[model samples]
Target: MLQKTYDSQICSLARALELVGERWSLLIVRDALFAGVTRFNDFQHNLGIATNVLASRLEAFVDAGIMERREVHGSPRQHTYALTAKGRDLAPTLVALTSWGDRWATDGEPPILFHHADCGAAVGVETTCARCGAVGHDGVQVAPGPGMPAEYLADRRPARPPQP
Candidate 1:
């Protein structure tokens, strides 16, 4: 678990909230990626998210490196949204969350079932380390990588000044 400093708590949640915690953000990611709806009008028509809110969410998503804006030719000077590599990395997170929701939230069975398109069998999801064959929760631990915050630098001093 993350440390309980006020700033850490707020920042941690805010970072994730920018993607999934908002009213329509995850749905936006879902539609853009899975449903193949790209245009502003298509999202509006499909999700019914208010115009202003959708605009704000799109801008936020772009700023967070989750989506990129690209020019749309032969149109009235509008742009389209595309996923970034970092954004595409969220695929596993989305899939795990969706699977958990399918298991626990639905009343009877999962309303939707995911099958292997090639083999045509019901599938269960699991996470395994490619480096090691261990297949348990203890086998998985998160460590900061190149994208981590500057304070994560090993040479940095501990008990640093509080952030605002």
Candidate 2:
């Protein structure tokens, strides 16, 4: 079982989980961002989500700025969900989680295979940057932004006492 931490004290990781921890929330984003689920009907049909639940989740996503609703050709009142930049940035997180799941959760063989369209070679779930060619988990890192607190940094790495 996971140990519980208060949100105020364990602010950073808690903040991340607060955004993504809800059930079916990240999956909804995954479907929209990677699977190309555009319309309300598409999300419901592709995911087999109940109509009311799907609508509520979509609204929550929109409110969180992960996705935006845009008017498609079909109906002026109807809108299609599209991933915003914030949502697109989550690809790496999803990729890492997918890699972990593939490694630990799989039987001897992968039931589902992903192929590289260009090379036609089967690709295991891994994040590779075309520009840098950096591979493996250590290659990925995130720096705290301006919003991060100096106190938090100090707590993490306090200055040592002066030597005699």
Candidate 3:
């Protein structure tokens, strides 16, 4: 297990990371979203995660309001975990991360592709400007928002050089 880092930063990204930064956390979420896994045994079987680790992750998820646990009606030891609305909102984030891995980490064609189930069209993830509809990584810039910490403002990077 990796030691948790505490950031005194006020950024939303930082806060979000505090909850999901653990190594197995987001992978667990990914399994729940993409593989429809719910039971503890299923998560254990599919992920091969240690029992204590899985239990800790599940308990953290439940505490964070990302997932809700329900007891099996007739079973004492069986429970199902389901994503709450807040958890479902992470689908796009997972898609974005997966797309990044597919592009930069793969040797050839991607092993898996995402598609719309309704129309069966392949889907790609990109950041788009809401104002101009300009797409891709280069079209956006980050500015200091109201919530930005003063330390960050004082020690910011120069504007990135254009990609070749």
Candidate 4:
């Protein structure tokens, strides 16, 4: 079983993993984000997920503010799940992950392709230099961001070489 929390970790990625690292969580989000899957029954049918497990995952997503549960129009006792803005923000992450999986994990060709909605062009994710806007995946490194705890930051500081 996957650990439910990364309470001891001070990293953003770890925190994100706490929510969507589960085997089914990202798949749920993907359907909602891409397929406009909002109805509970639709999710169950599409994913072949157990109803109880879907209910639990939806409840957790609602609690986390990643998704909001709303009553379906004209259907009492029935609910549809909608992604909150915070949840929709995960699209790029999903796209990037898909790109990596297509390249590394899957056989043959990519099963799906993403494209821009406003124009007929391919959509992809890339890392870029913040200051110069140069595009590449190299030279990336982690450091303490402003929100990191002081003690954690101090402990994680990269060792410096002696000055000449």
Candidate 5:
């Protein structure tokens, strides 16, 4: 379990990890986003996760503004979990991670495919430069951004260029 905090770290990725860093949290979000799972029981069944753990993750997600828990009109104490815009925004991350897993982690061909909903074309993700339109991470560089504390970055730099 991740019991400690990355409070000393001044990075957005660290913050993101704090929110959805757990394997099951990401899996739950993936099912909610891709498989349209909305109910607690559905998530429990699909993921085969313990009720307590699922409940905690769902609560955390709701608190983080990632998902909204809505009461079902006709049922008592029944609700549906819906991904907010912020939660749906994780789709690309899941897709890219899935692609990477298929390529490097799996032994066989991809078992699933992601396609463009509008044109039905196969979809893929990549990092691109806005100015030169350069594709991939090779052209990427890390420097002080507006959010980074100047002193922190003044004497520190990335050990290697980012591959993502």
Candidate 6:
């Protein structure tokens, strides 16, 4: 069985999960990205997260290179967290997750909307094929790639016989 920690997995997704898979981690990133929340008090006020948990999550983010902590206002005491380039790169992932939630989880209209900064038009995440243009979930297929471990390949169920 695959471990919940996924330490043995060689997949990129597994590696990413290790960094920001905790419940509060992505929300912290979301606030940093969309709400411009930086300070510990601001995060606590916005998220209502406990002090110790928030501190630990922030430290993990900093250690993972997703955020940087720096002193605020040249005061050796006060500090703020800022997203690094790696953290900003999670925008699309968050957007996609938001889109899905808005579709299937919400009761009424979406509580928040995303807009294109340049045109001020609503935007959403979509899957597009490089050569064939847009595609839906049914149009996508997974196959073993060069990065697939031999053990993973062996564990995969045998391909079904071709339909008659």
Output the number of the lDDT-best candidate.
6
Per TM-score, what order, best first? 4, 5, 6, 3, 1, 2
TM-score of each: 0.67, 0.66, 0.84, 0.91, 0.90, 0.89
Error at 148, model 1, angstroms: 9.0
TM-score leader: 4
lDDT string for model 3 (1-164, tens) is: 54465565656877788778888888899999989999999999999999999999999899999999999999977899999998989989888888899889999998878899899998866677778775766666677788777787788776776689
Cα displacement (angstroms), candidate 1, residue 5, comes to 12
Per-residue lDDT over 25-45 for candidate 5, one digit per residue giving the tens place of the 0 to 100 score: 999999999899999999999
Winner on lDDT between 3 and 4 is: 4
Q: What is the C-alpha RMSD of each candidate to the true structure, in Å?
A: 7.1, 6.0, 3.0, 3.0, 2.8, 2.8
**Residue 15 of model 1: what lDDT?**
62
| Model with the higher lDDT, candidate 1 or 2 | 1
lDDT of 6 at 48: 98
**Model 6 alpha-carbon drift over 4 Å, by segment:** 1-4, 154-164
- Residues 113-133, candidate 6: write the lDDT tens digits: 999999999888899999999
Candidate 4, 71: how far from true, in Å? 0.6
Where model 2 places Cα greater than 4 Å from the true spot, the runs are: 1-6, 112-164
Q: Give the Cα error of residue 94 in candidate 5, in Å.
A: 0.6
| Model 5 stretches astray by more than 4 angstroms | 154-164
Q: In model 4, which range of ten residues has the least summed lDDT? A: 134-143
lDDT of 4 at 139: 59
